[model samples]
Target chain A: MSTVVLLTLTGLGLAALYFLVASGLALVFGLADVLNFAHGLFLSVGAYGTWWASGNLPGAGASGWGFVLAVIFGVVCGTVVAALVELVLIRPLYSRTIEQVLVTVGLSLAGVALLQASWGADPRTYPRPQWTQELTEVAGARVPNDRFLLIGAAVIVLAGLLAFLKFTRIGLVIRAGVEDRSMVTALGIDVRRAFTLVFAIGGAAAALAGALGGVYAGSISPTGGSSLLIFGFIVVVIGGMGSVVGAAYAAVAVGLLQQFVNYTSPGLGDICVVALLAIVLLIRPQGITGKVATS
Target chain B: MLRIEGLSAWHGEAQVLRDVDLFVERGEVVTLCGRNGAGKTTLLRCVMGLHGNQTGAVHLDGDDITARKVHQRARRGLGWVPDDRGAYATLTVAEHLTLPPVVGPAPWSLEQVHEAFPALYTRRASPATKLSGGEQQMLALARVLRMGATVLLCDEPTEGLSPLLVQQVGEILRRAKALGVTVLLVEQNIHFATTVADRHYLLAEGRIVGHFDNTDIHSREADLLAHLGI
Candidate 1:
């Protein structure tokens, strides 16, 4: 019914965050070959950074540009953390995939702990501001106006990102690097610089995702990123790891599927979705989208 | 234009290359002809300075390039088209041609390379993975030419090309020699060496075993084959 349609729409609206976070992680993993477990921590930090900037900053960003200010702050904090992590940790373990996996996992845990201490364990509310409370009728159901904004924002962000990756110089280098690290470097590209930029970009996108997630969920806990991490992993797995477009498509499909489960079984909806994903893995080991093009 | 002295490389104590002494002057097409496991590719890699534990003195343009990064050497006019062709699967032939960071470029463009080898122009927009072996080799060559380097280290440039395409490659090399490009071509094709290379340095068990000029290689075919273990 109309409720199910609303739920599906809600899922689509949320797919924006998934696309942002997963695409960045996919690039990092694909290009740098780093399995970054600490990626989710950037989300929580981005959420907190947005909160601090929009909620506490002086009259500078307190006006109608609160949302934009929050997003910018999130991007900055995300990028800084990414650079720090790369310089301090990832640089040492470059090309050591197994060590990278272990270190990133440990770093991730440490990041969660750091967020818990900095922002506290209790969840924090992030209201979508007064202007965003407007309602719209979707399939005869009243939908929050902010949800429409979320959907629009996601589309805009994704389109802009796609354009950047397609048309820009660094973007072309990045895509090329993912295909063959050796060949790209041999062509006079500094692989290290590209790797750092890729990680920073991923961090920025994760931060943006956090900001969007704050508006959508109404509150974000310190551990908010953990669930996101899980969801991203599932989407990446199902979509075929290292594929940007595949992650986008898989996010929508998984989001809709999750919404359907919520409708079918309210209490065990999460479990139902997990079971469905398990079934998917059993059938398609390469995931729903299959492998990316190798060099 | 290039020199390596007492260069030794180890893949974590395996010691793949030992005291490898090699040199190539400007505008020279020298071949690192060698037997299997003779470290021909390793010598090319050493010149590129692509390994961390590689101990050597690599000099280019009369400067010690031993400490420089791989890309730095590349920018200093060392272009390497690896044996793998390095064909980025998703990238189009046009993108591959356009992506290399070309400096001081009074050289060929994609149009010119395509004019030289028309097959590339035909598949200009095609994904590189979809290209046939011959076309892929052409793409790699075109991509390197687009980089506008003075020296090219082509590791097995004619590995999997058809005979007709191989003939075309020999013509390309002849044209390249005319263009004043120094080619350190690592080739297995005897015909290619006889056709295009001015000099040959055969290697065995990671050391230079024999040297030959174009005429020496043609007349001493048995010695060349025996030295290369072909």
Candidate 2:
């Protein structure tokens, strides 16, 4: 049925965004053991960056170019913010888990306040690309072009990330560092560089999600960061805290569940996600795909 | 070449290494022999810059590395194979060898390392957690060798390994010395150390109590064992 196609498409689109955000959180935690509480703020900052770029830059208001430019600018800005946070706050707190949590939470609150002060509390709308606004008919089902674009982008990012992890030297070290930092350092690896690189990449991924959400949903609000943060955390917990593949699968599952719940009763969507998270925890304390840590 | 002068390390308030002075010339295999709580591990950590509250000077190739970080010390040709083996659960045996930045000239290639330690070739794709204790030890040693460390600081490299693997480890160290690599190892096994080392320092209660060359090691074995209470 057309309804099934619509639900699947929409669910996949939403899952892509969730994967982006959750994967960033997972990677940062995996590498540095720094549970970045300020991660959600990166999303809002990125959304705002895109808004500023599209509005201020000349010729950026045109179709595909505008959205693409906005996303690029947003990702860069978000990376800068995350790099600064790492330098100023994260580096010193590497051995102190409680301190890292406290400091990052404070940073997130400050980020939200800064955004409110600069952009005001009003919700801002982001214009979808002209090309993406048109609906396409596929197998007698109507779907927006941007939905397909979102899914394509997700696949590309996932493939690119996997290839990088599997083939590149830095990626190998990052993967190694995630499991045993001291060993990586012993091998003469500059693990700080690895941590920094992962943190920056995580920030960029989160920012990309923000930009994607802004384009597809057409709105950026002050509470956007916290809301996305909750969703990301839920996905991570369900997927396994440090597994990217697990996050992707979990995100899609959550997205589909949310869409189904929304179709039945809008109020029950979030409740369903929480219930699913609880069930996953109860069944596999280590999350769906997580192996019990050995060392 | 490696030197430790007036090295004193502390775990919080209690000092573990007291004015520990030691040296290993290029192409020599030196073992710091001691029992448990003798500050052998702490001395190696201080050299690696892992112990922050240490007041000491570690020199590598006549350069003061006392102030350097762990990674910096490593980059300066100090390779550490800690007792824990630094095995990462996520990385496979092949990745462990490839992950560290290759340093120095004419280091062992992957094929060469596989040939040197045949047990690793079969488990090249196995994660660290899946590998047996002996396999992990071999992987750890292989990693440092592949990284081309001129001075290898191995902390209990043969601990918890089978006797066969221990003999293999001894052979590996002998081969390393023949290739002109310097080794500073902490060992509880005197038999293994005697097979590999040119000189030995007996450590007790965080200080260097005695030193002996290989020629005198046999004569000093009983005295050393008494000091080690073996």
lDDT of each: 0.79, 0.84
lDDT of 1 by residue, A130-242 (tens): 66676778778877766676678667766766677778878788778766777777788887887787788778878878877887788888889878988887777677767
For each model in turn, which proportion of the native inter-chain contacts is also found?
Answer: 0.72, 0.80
Residue pairs with backbone overlap in model 1: none
Single out the weakest 10-residue window by summed lDDT for candidate 2 chain A.
A286-295
* Model 1: lDDT to the true structure: 0.79
Relative to the true structure, candidate 2 reaches a TM of 0.88
Superposed by TM-score, candidate 2 places the C-alpha of residue B167 at a distance from the truth, in angstroms, of: 1.9
Q: Per-residue CA lDDT of candidate 2, range B44-130, in tens?
A: 888888777888788888999887878888888888888988887777888888788877775789888999999889898888769
Candidates in order, TM-scores: namely 0.90, 0.88
**Model 1 residue B64 distance off true place after TM-score fit, in angstroms:** 2.3
Q: Per-prediction interface RMSD?
A: 2.9, 3.5
Off by over 4 Å in 1: A60-64, A87-89, A98-103, A131-135, A267-295, B11-13, B51-53, B227-230
